[model samples]
Target: MSAKVPASPRFAYKGDRLKPLRAFCQTARLGSISRAAEALFLSQPAVTLQLQALEREFGARLLERSGRRISLTREGQELYELARPLVEGLDGLDGAFRERVRGLDAGELNVAAGSSTILYLLPKIVEAFRATHPEVRLTLHNVTGAGGLDLLRSDAVDLAVGSMLDVPADLSYEPVYRFEPMLITPRNHPLAQKAELELQDLSPYGLILPPQRLTTYRLVDLVFQQNRVPYTVALEVGGWEVIKQYVAMGLGISIVTSICLTEADRERLATRSLARYFPSRSYGVVVRKGKYLSPHARAFTELIRPALFEREDYYANGQSER
Candidate 1:
C-alpha cells in the first residue's frame, strides 16, 4: 500500500493536493525548512516530505540545501514565482472574497512608503483612515523605493505611496503632490543670499547626499552628469531630516524638498528654490498591475486619488486594471 499522506493543519481544504506547493513556497520565502514548518505549524519531516513529493512530480530539484540554510534553484525560483500568487490567493480568498460580498467591514491593508513620505505626507490621511475604518487593520511598512516594489510583487503590501521618475511596465503610478526642490545652506552661507541658484552655482560647496541606491541620489547624479558639473561630496547621509540637521551644524549643504522646510527652518537655514534647475518632485500612489484591490484598499486609494474613484460605483463592479 502507498504511504498515507501527512496531515497538514495549515491548509485542510484539498487533502494533500496543495501541500507540496504550499511547502515549497513557504520554504522558498522563509529560506529554511525548520522555519517554514514552524510557520505552517507542521513538523519538519512533514514539510520535507511535501517538498520531496513536489520535486519528484516536477522531476527537477527544487531547493539547494546548504546545512540548515536553503535557496531556490533557477527552476525552483520560476516555480516559486508561479506558485506564490496562487498560494496567496488561496490564503487570502476569505478576506478578498468577503470584501467582495460583505463590503469591507473588516480587513487588513498593508501600504509601503519611503521614510519621509510616511513621516510627513501620510499622518493626516492615516488618521482619517483610522477614524473612518476602525474595524480594518492598516499597516504602514517603512520600505525604501526599490523595496516597496518587491513588497507589492510578493503580495506583502497592497499598495505603495512615493515618488517615481521611472515606473516599471507592470506597475502604475498616479501623481498626488508636487514639491519644489530646494538647496539649503547654513544661514551665514553666501549662496543662501542669492534669490536664484543654478546647478553650476552650487558646484563649489561639498554636498551632503543620501545613499546612492535611493532615487534622490540618482536624480542628483543624473542632473549633475548631464550639466557636466563637478561637485564634491562633503558627507554621505540618509534621510532629509539627518541631512538637514548636518546642514544646520554647518557640516555641509544639501538639496531637500520644499515639503521638508518649515518657517522655523527658514530662520536657521537659508533656502533657494531649485525648481529651475531640478524638476519638481511628484509623489504619488503606486499599485501593481492587474492585482485586485479590496474594498478597503480601494477606499484608501480613493482617499489618496479622490478623482480616480469619484464614480462612487467603481467598487460595485470588479476592478479593471489601472
Candidate 2:
C-alpha cells in the first residue's frame, strides 16, 4: 500500500487562517467571549475553539479570565498592538480598493477641529480642497478638549487639525504652523501704546480670556505663576471672535494667539507680541497612532501640508513622530 500523504499545515483548518486571529482580536477587545461572539456573529463555542487554536498555535496564553471578564496577558497585549492594524487594514481592504479605483471623485472625509482652527487655520485649506475635490463629502466636527480626542480614538473622525500642548502616546501630533503669543486690547488701551511690554506690566488690568479649562488660560497662568506675576481674569468667554470683540469694546485686555489675528483684527485691536513671555502655539495634524487613513483623508491632509506622511512608517506601523 502506498504511504499515506501528510496533511498540509495550511489546510489543517477550514476557511481563512485569519479567522482565528480575528476571533482572538475581537475577544481581546470586548473582554467577553459572548460579546465578541455577538460582534463576530459566531457562537461562543466557536470563538472559544478559535481562541484555543490561536493559543496553541502561538504556544502562549493570550488571555486570562476571571468570572465573566477577560483581559489580555502581556503577550496578548503585544500581539494585539501588532495585529490590530493588520486586521483593520484587511477589513477595510475592499472599501479601500474601491476608493483607489474611483479616486477622490467619490469618498467622504471627516475631520475634527476646534472653532478657532475651523475659522482661522482650515478656511484656506478647506477652500482649496473643496475646489479640487468638490465631489468628496467633507464634514468637520467642531470639538475641543476631550471631545475631539474621543472622536479620534473612536475613529469617528479621520484626523484632527488643531493645537496640542500635551500629546498622548496613542496619538501623533505633527505641528506645521507656529503662531506667536500676542496681547490684544482696544486700539486706545494704554498697554498697547507701551514701547516695550513685560509680563508684570498687565498685572493691574483684569484680563478677558477664554475659559480656564482651555490651554490658553492654563499656559498664561503657568507663565504668570512661574514669574510670580499675579493676574486676574475679568470675564470667561469662548470663541476668538467674541474675545476679540469684547476686547475691542474695551471689556479688558486679553492674551491671544496670532493665528486668529487678521488685518481687520489688527486694525480693531492694538496687538503687541507677548512671545517673550509666552511660548508660540503650534497647530498641526493629529492622528490615532495606528489609524489607516483613507485616500480621501490622505488627500485632505496633503492640502494642509504637501507630502504629509509620505514616509512608509507613518501609515504602516503608525509609529512616525514629528
Per-model RMSD to reference: 14.0, 12.7
Worst 10 residues of 2 by lDDT: 313-322
What does the lDDT read for residue 294 in candidate 1?
A: 84
Taking the tens digit of each residue's C-alpha lDDT, what string does model 2 give over 9-43?
55344477678778888988889999999999999
TM-score of each: 0.64, 0.64
Model 1 scores worst on lDDT over the 10 consecutive residues at 313-322
Candidate with best lDDT: 2
Compared with the true structure, all predictions reach lDDT values of 0.80, 0.83
- Per-residue C-alpha lDDT of model 1 across residues 1-322, encoded as one tens digit per residue: 9999998444342376677788889999999999999999999999998887777767799899877789999999999999999999898999988775754455788999988888767776787788888888899999986788999998899899888888999998888767777788898887876655668988889999999887778888888898899988899988888898899899988887765665467567877767766887777889999998888888887676553233223211221111
Model 2 stretches with alpha carbons more than 4 Å out:
1-105, 306-322
Candidate 2 lDDT at 227 equals 99
